[model samples]
Target: MERNAPVSRFGTVEVEDLPDDLRERLAPVVERSGFTPNIFRALGRRPAELRAFLDYHDALMTSDEGLSRAERELVVVATSGANGCPYCVVAHGAILRLRTKEPHLADLVATNPHGCELEPRQRAIVDLALRLALHPAGFGEADLRAARDAGLTDDEIWDVGSITAFFAASNRLAHLFGLRPNDEFFTMGR
Candidate 1:
């Protein structure tokens, strides 16, 4: 590892030293971001798990599902914030700002979704996502009804819950591994 390379508390695996599959996966992310995110590098410690993780991430975040990219990122920011995941909050918040073209929206949603002045549909989505993240056991049919009443389709409702569930795992992973958000995330979209 380079002396200055960002290292997670669990340690990082060098990209070049990673398996061929992992190196291939990291290439595009590095090309797009101009640097390998610490999550990629750190999670690379387990190539197989990273592959599975990234595959699931791509399916959930990139696929043309009921949620738009911005909406998915909104779910991430909201849920991750409720989970107290600094890394996801900052990183996905940057993505949210970029997608929405609202610089302060990220911080507002992460810190206080109610204060974000979200549209009614968006508020329903955020509220449901947060409830799932903060208290999954408490999630109920009424929550789905509220989301549907706000114009979310059943597919969209599934997405809201799925994205929230995924990020709940991601948030805990960040906490467990002590993952840090890239510095670039702090200023991107602003």
Candidate 2:
């Protein structure tokens, strides 16, 4: 391991030293983002788990989902913020900014969705996401009804909850692994 590389509590795997399959998976992300996100490098230590993580991530966050790409990223940022995972908040916040094309929106959403200038739909999405993230047992049918009232289709509501639940696990893993946000993420959309 390089002395200069960032190390989580469990120690990180350098991208270059990663298995061919893992490096191949990371190539497009590095190509598009101009750097390997630390999540990939750090958690890439366990290639199997990392592959599984990336697979599920790709499945959920696509534009083809009921949520727009920006909306998906918005759910990630808000849920990460509420869950106190700075890694996801910073990384996905950058994505949210890029997708939404609003440089400051991510910051506001990460800090406090209620304090941000969210449209009604956006508010409803994040509100439901946060509720699920912070208090899943309380996420009753009333919440579902509220989501429907706010114009979220069944698919959109499903996506919001799924995204939030996924990020909840992601956030906990970040904490477990002592993951940190890469420096590249801070200024990505700004």
Candidate 3:
């Protein structure tokens, strides 16, 4: 695996060395982001898994009916924080800021949603995401009831769980591989 840049724990396989399909897929991400996110490079070590993971991630993050883009990214940021994955926290926090157009919101949510000055609905949602991260097995019917009472639709509730679950896997992967957030992530949407 050849790394184009020194951004990942396991250096990203060089773009030229990637299989044709992988190269095609990665080109646009690099072009649009101006750099490859470390997750993309780290996961690229296993081309098949990278494709599968990206497909699922695109579906989960881009779905329009369930949660708004900002809401989805919030779930990721909050859960990533709970998991203590700074890479996800920083990267997703940048995305969350872009989506919400509020420069301070991501840092607020990532560090402490409960103490943050969020609307009731956002507070409920972030709280749920955090609990899901910290206590997946402890989720209960009351949790669902609370979210519903906070005005989240059934679809949105489902989205919250799905995003959190996906990032749980991603956060663990980053920790396992020692992936670091790209430097661009820190200043993005600032």
Question: By lDDT, who's the top model here?
Answer: 2
Candidate 1's TM-score: 0.94
List TM-score per model, in order.
0.94, 0.94, 0.93
Q: Model 3 Cα displacement at 95 (Å)?
A: 1.0
Native-structure RMSD, model 1: 2.7
- Residue-wise C-alpha lDDT for candidate 1, range 6-111, written one tens digit per residue: 4578888878889997898789988887877888888888888899889989889996869898999999999998988988998899889999999987798899
lDDT head-to-head 1 vs 2, winner: 2
Which candidate model has the greater TM-score, 1 or 3? 1
Q: In candidate 2, how many Å is residue 64 off? A: 1.3
Ranking by TM-score: 1, 2, 3
User: Model 1, residue 156: displacement in angstroms?
Assistant: 0.5
Model 2 over residues 90-179: C-alpha lDDT tens digits?
899989888888998888988877778899999999899988988898889999999999999999998998899899999999888778
Residue runs of model 1 more than 4 Å from their true location after superposition = 1-6
Tell me the TM-score of model 2. 0.94
Give Cα-based local distance difference scores for all models: 0.86, 0.87, 0.87
Per-candidate clashes come to: 0, 0, 2
Worst 10 residues of 3 by lDDT: 1-10
